[model samples]
Target: MPSQITRQITRHVLTIPAQGGKPARKVHYRRCGQGPALLMVHQSPRSSSEYTELMRDWAAHFTCIAPDTPGFGQSDPLPGEPEINDFADAILEFADALGIAPCAAYGFHSGGIILVTAIKRRPQAFRCLAVGGYAIWTPEEMRIFGESYLPEFVPQPYGEHLAWIWSRILEQSWVFPWFDTREEARMSIAHADVEHVARTVSEMLDAGEHYRAGYGAVLRAPRDIPAPDAVVPPCLISAYDGDPLQAHIDRLGAMPASWSAQKVATPKEHQDLSLAFLKEHADTAPCGALPEDGHEGWLELEGGLIHWKGAKGGRLRLHRPAEELADPSKGEIAIDVPGHGQSDDFDDMKRAVEASAEALGVSDIDWPAPPAGDADRLYPDMAPDRFGLYLQRAWQVARAEAFFAPWYEANAAHAVPLTPEAIATPAVHARALARIRAGAAARRWHDTLAQIQGETA
Candidate 1:
């Protein structure tokens, strides 16, 4: 057994041109470790962040790279409703753009289907695959799923879908179809942990309205097992006990000599065996150098990638300033707050701010107050019919002050060292559209605050 190695994980984005003359799509990815590359694809409605822990463990032996599949994270969705093969081809494009090939792969559920399809479409791109769960759904099941499983996941300003999302994630383990309320379909492993629910909600928020396209494609994908005569890369499909796909392993029936299926006692055991198998079949050598961390680029922190601009010197962190209007030249450092601009969001503001500060390589700095009465003005594009516009507006105000909101009063003293020109930096205008896109999360923040105040009062 190889000893576990610690490596600095890095996040970056690259734009890949569309097949036609359409605009390019930006793909965001996280990479770590220092050996042969292992590509990881996450389950639907999730991102590369899902593999952070596993990437850390596998980094000791492989250069683990996890990408946010299109439509699920920062990565852009397909030009139109994609077929499963299109998703698979996108993975190949992702690998080609990064210049890594003949690598091993791992995925979970929808991710498994995507990776398997990718390998089937381009056998030379991968040496082997380890799948956590691979569903082989029947026509009936597919019909049922296609109808309801992935309805348009658009944002409802009032967050009308919040309850549905919460219940769906919580009850998924308890029911086979999740929508089925029949007693016979209930499993024993149902859990309602707040933290877990919050995590799922955060990922869903990241996917927003586009999750339906990606997830729907997988549910509608062909579940064909390679015949013994077909040439395919080595593959291992294992599902942990109690996983919904555990029974589907039997549906795989007869697979090629290069493929194997098993039911693992636990997820951890499954991961261990899969990792070992991938390493055993890995054929490529590591790139020999770790990805460089840039001083003027994005940093992968706990929640999501934190975008930083300006040369390293006197640091000036902008608090919800219009990104386009504020000049990066005015300060040595500037950041896009989580849930704002190019940065990602967390369920909690304190954690977001703390991570940003750490990524900024600053202990403390001058905190400036945001311009008054600008939150609502910044989000003019929000739908008037949205029920939580008020809350979203309030959240925008709090978002501007999130760094200090957790520690100090919103109106507390915030020293202004820079001139009015600096106070009204143009960068603030750059991210207004980004802020509008994050209105759903602002609604979540509203719900969180209501709970907090209700608990205290």
Candidate 2:
């Protein structure tokens, strides 16, 4: 047996074919390890980021591939109100794009719903599946969830949505549906950890209003598993105590002979069982060549992996702190500077930028103009507070910057002229998310640019 070896997870963008009226779009994915491909799908409102640690460990046994489902993470959304099949077919397109068909697979929660549908649609595409907590919702359960589960998540002018979502994701573990605070709704295992809640909140913020579509599609989907007599891939379905979907294991009465459901004592036990099941049934053949991003990818340099897009040399455009690459498709080479966007952190951002330009064979650095205000007041570091107030802070900062040039001075004297579109919800949401995600390093980027510009001047 090959000893477990750690592999660095690499991200790539695969273009899925256009469907319905929607145009073709990029699907961001993470890959690790080397062996037969094992496709993993994540639950709703969360991206493939959930599989990072698992991918690292599983890398020893299989080539793990996980993609951000549409409208989640960096992947784009499908047009209109897409149903279960649309998402299932999208998964197929994703797998086909990589030429990794008939691969071993795993999915959790909403992910289980998607992969189950995909396997049923084309059994030959997968060799086996390991599902975590499959749901077989009763009509009454569906009706109850339908009424209160997915509230339209619109961004509010006063940061009301920020507060609402933070609390909602935080309380999700406290109660089954999160919204229902009644004692009957409480879960056996509950946690109020700031770190865990913050991560879920961040992913939720990333999904935005599109979360409803992905989540609703799964909640309303019919029994995702195929009939007992149907030919399908070898599979194992399991759930642990405290999981809401564990009860649904009993609901899955008649399944294919190759598929079996098990109740585990703990999450670790469930994962352990799934891993063993996958190892036993995993395909022996190695995965084929994977598609690569034409315009955007990570560039390894002195500092860290800097995410760059477009052909180099028109100009090396740099977005200032509290922001990321403005427009990647604007006929200019743009990079998510160190500690910003998708780029990894580096202490000396100036050196990082210089190294990037040198590698890209570009001399022109089109740096963004500096903000006109006290740096201290303008940049708050936007740390995650225990109550998650930092979310609202970032939101307000994004809004404030739009209305006032410095964002600290509330008076009309500092007011900047901008149209309603400039401060629109989507626009501000992007800005706020940037700030929340990378605002801590904004100062380093700002200082780096300032020094470079000062020397040039």
Candidate 3:
């Protein structure tokens, strides 16, 4: 019989007094497991609830602490509309309230931006930092992102725009002109997973409009982190294949000496790498780990966790995946990405990717080559004026398809092969089936001709 996965944990809601003339606010948090301290920060349009599952697995390695950022989840809105820096201050207060003077930290997306800002302001307070898909958009890129990627505020009720919003977030890899390079284009198409996209969409919708503040702040804030060259500490930045931030790898590349960047193909890879790095270096300073369970899966990334062992202490095990061990060039580490398995944070894509690859025992992979052909010309029919909207729609469909394709393919094996009558149930369904059949027939014909020619030779 398999061992039952135990779900041991505790919950707390404490009022953390604001620092520097701000009023106190009720902060909701979850604490579990036993070990060093680790703090988990959630991205925009979501709450700390995102890490609930991933925390289970991490509890074995560290005392996981995940809090709902002010104005999101159960936490109250800030005394006033706050910027990313203000959010960081709230965390500092939260840390003080919990008696965590110096702890390790991890964050994803907007959460990462805040943590990075916090660490820059108080470098000595953190032992190390790991971020997923960190965005350091250049001035030009920020202009484009703001004009296209920022969600428009609509007065329509939540349900009305939920689907549209969800789709927009999911289909980002598809139709988004930002990723014009060949390798990114191919990987984006190949990695589209509709189910995952749908789930992410759903979660965002559930989190509601209050989450928009974080996104807005991220978009408007300047991309500036003073050099940590003087008080450098180990830092990791990671991202997956379809991460929008992947385009700004150069910006992140300029990180201080103590920082490293990596690009990964999936979120799980990011978590594992961050965890391994944290575990290896969790003794030199104070640290905090969130979501204590060693098996609880995280939101979106599924089987993920967060762990902060300390600054530097513990038996460091160098476990690399078999394929990675064979080829030392792959550069994958033997740890899990946060919110994917047993790790946390989602702000720095490159670092996450490199760390994940190392954790998985694979050597680092080269950045993918840009896509071939004229990317701008591919969608001529798309209105130039509304390119962002059109691309956003296309991206939505692509992500939905990516998420659902695997399940659909698996289920197809148990059902009867598609027949004209079966597909004719809906007009849209029939048209899609016809397209599939045509594509399949074309491939078969080409294969048959090749085989015949080979036989004759």
Please report the candidate that would top lDDT against the real structure: 2
RMSD to the true structure for each prediction, in A, is 9.5, 2.1, 18.9
lDDT for each residue of candidate 1 in 234-338, tens digit (9 for 90 to 100): 999999888888988888988889999999989899999998899899975775543332444676676456677655554656553333214365546776655
Q: What is the C-alpha lDDT profile of model 3 across 1-457, one tens digit per residue?
A: 1112324545556776555677767777766566778888888767776786767777677677888887776577776567877788778878878877587778888888888878867777777888888777667767776676555544231123534664565555465543333454443453346545544543454345566666777666767655656575678888876777766666754567778888887778988888887777665433443322221222222233322221122222221110011111222223322222223434443345455444333453433222222323221222212212332332332222223332133354434345444233233222221222122222222233344446656
Tens digits of per-residue lDDT for model 2, 60-130: 88889999999999899988898998899889989888999888999999999999999888999998999
Under the 3 Å rule for N, CA and C atoms, how many clashes does model 3 have?
112
User: What is the TM-score of candidate 3?
Assistant: 0.56
Q: In candidate 3, residue 249 scores what lDDT?
A: 61
Q: Regarding TM-score, does 1 or 2 come out ahead?
A: 2
Task: Give the count of colliding residue pairs in each prediction.
Answer: 17, 1, 112
Instruction: Indicate the worst ten consecutive residues by lDDT in candidate 2.
Output: 1-10
Off by over 4 Å in 1: 1-5, 288-296, 300-305, 309-317, 321-334, 337-367, 370-457
